[model samples]
Target: MSVTGGRVPDHHPAHHRARGRRGGLSPVPYVATTTRILRQLAGDHRSVAMIVVVPSAIIALMFFMFQDAPRRPGVPSPFDDACLIMLGVFPLVVMFLITSITMQRERASGTLERILTTPLRRLDLLAAYGTAFSIAAAAQATLACVVSFWLLGLDTAGSPALVFVIAIINAVLGVGLGLLCSAFARTEFQAVQFMPLVIVPQLLLCGIIVPRDVLPGWLQWISDVLPASYALEALREVGAHPEMTATAVRDVAVVVGFAVLAMGLAAATLRRRTP
Candidate 1:
């Protein structure tokens, strides 16, 4: 259509092809970014000890305290069940703490802003953070449980594999929520403060100390909306009953759904540069 052109080419084909592509979430950037984060974390021994070693040691101590408690021939003691639940809760707490601080540090250091200057999308950064921490969380869950059951002689009705899976889900939930929370913090100290605002309430309300049913109606309804409630419930069900019941499956689904929601929220709130 141009005056100097012998012929004009239609752009419809290119546009049509681009539109035909699914254009869903991409894996290339996510994988590369996750690999880099994991490599960086691997070099920090103190961080490694805090994440994987300290929790296991605490659980081992709990086992030592209850090692001689009397129990039924095939059933675990009440303390054992509590320990099993802690195996899930500890990882969730640690992952949330570590992820929030890491994200805040990156933001403070301008690393996240610099990375955004490249081809990385906000979702890519969230995914990488989630994926990398999730792997570390899984390893921690496995090691903690192995040490508890084999070395410390801890007992639970659930299969060890199921506990591991639930722990991983809880940890991922932590990671996603941590990333979302980091967006609200102006400093790393603010991120640390969130443990009380975000986690302590969940711990108290998630039936760790008391039964959710026995709480007031208002309290029960509040627990209904918190992802930790479902996670703790799932852990209790597996630890006490060791069955893949409908309730257990539903709880797991809700926990995972919250994780996805948190990650989506983080991505939505992300900015190309600091405001």
Candidate 2:
């Protein structure tokens, strides 16, 4: 028992209650976690290359493949039509892979369990991760937009700024989905497997191979619910129009809604200890 002001207070009920209270949500843990993640990402050279270099390389290869393909009069070239979708796709895919695998590693290493033992709330941890990766996602989007427009000669009727915004949103969507999926995985290999399960169907059905409307009716219904479908639709809008259209706004809203829902579910899945 400790003495305070000549009175012993260690056994007091108020002291017991104070000790029993869980930590309140605060910005301190959130900011610290975000900073820690950003620093970790910055220090990883391979991850840096994967995030910053790989997507641009893929886009350049696409540019070369379609550079000489003929376009019918008054019709945009195939690459011109497809690359805008790709701008968002590459960021989404890359961010998703990086995030899921990284988070899974944390689970395997027991870092997440240790962090949860402290006063930090699950929302703080997840939100910090989302925010940290969103910053990286913004950087990735900016670089890809610059390379696609200036270096590779990709053309679009919409403002380059709008394309960047769509790309960033897609990347953030990936981050949210990745975090959600990671909770279901026990290993990095399992996390990688989720990509095919989650991403491939969306890619195929998101009007990448054919206009989504022409797909089988059930496939069309599935596409309607996938965020990638709307992401591509928004890209198509930006490519075909100089100003944002009502349809593009709706498409973006859908993607943002999915991102928010995924994050909330991921928070729910977070545990102080995982098997």
Q: Which candidate is the best by TM-score?
A: 2
Which 10 consecutive positions of candidate 2 have the poorest summed lDDT?
A: 17-26
| Alpha carbon lDDT at 49, candidate 2 | 87
Top candidate on lDDT is 2
User: Each model's TM-score, in the order given?
Assistant: 0.89, 0.91
lDDT of 1 at 257: 97
lDDT of 2 by residue, 34-69 (tens): 999999999999998899888888888999999889
Q: What is residue 207's positional error in candidate 2, in angstroms? A: 0.3
Steric clash pairs (candidate 1): none
Candidate 1: residue 86 lDDT (0-100): 86
How does model 1 score by TM-score?
0.89
- Report the lDDT tens digits of candidate 1 across residue range 1-275: 33375644456565544443335545777799999999988988887887899889888788777767788887768567868878879988999989988898888888998988766677777889988999999889988988977887766677878888999999999998898888898888998899998888899999888889999999999988999999988887887776676888999999999999999998888654345
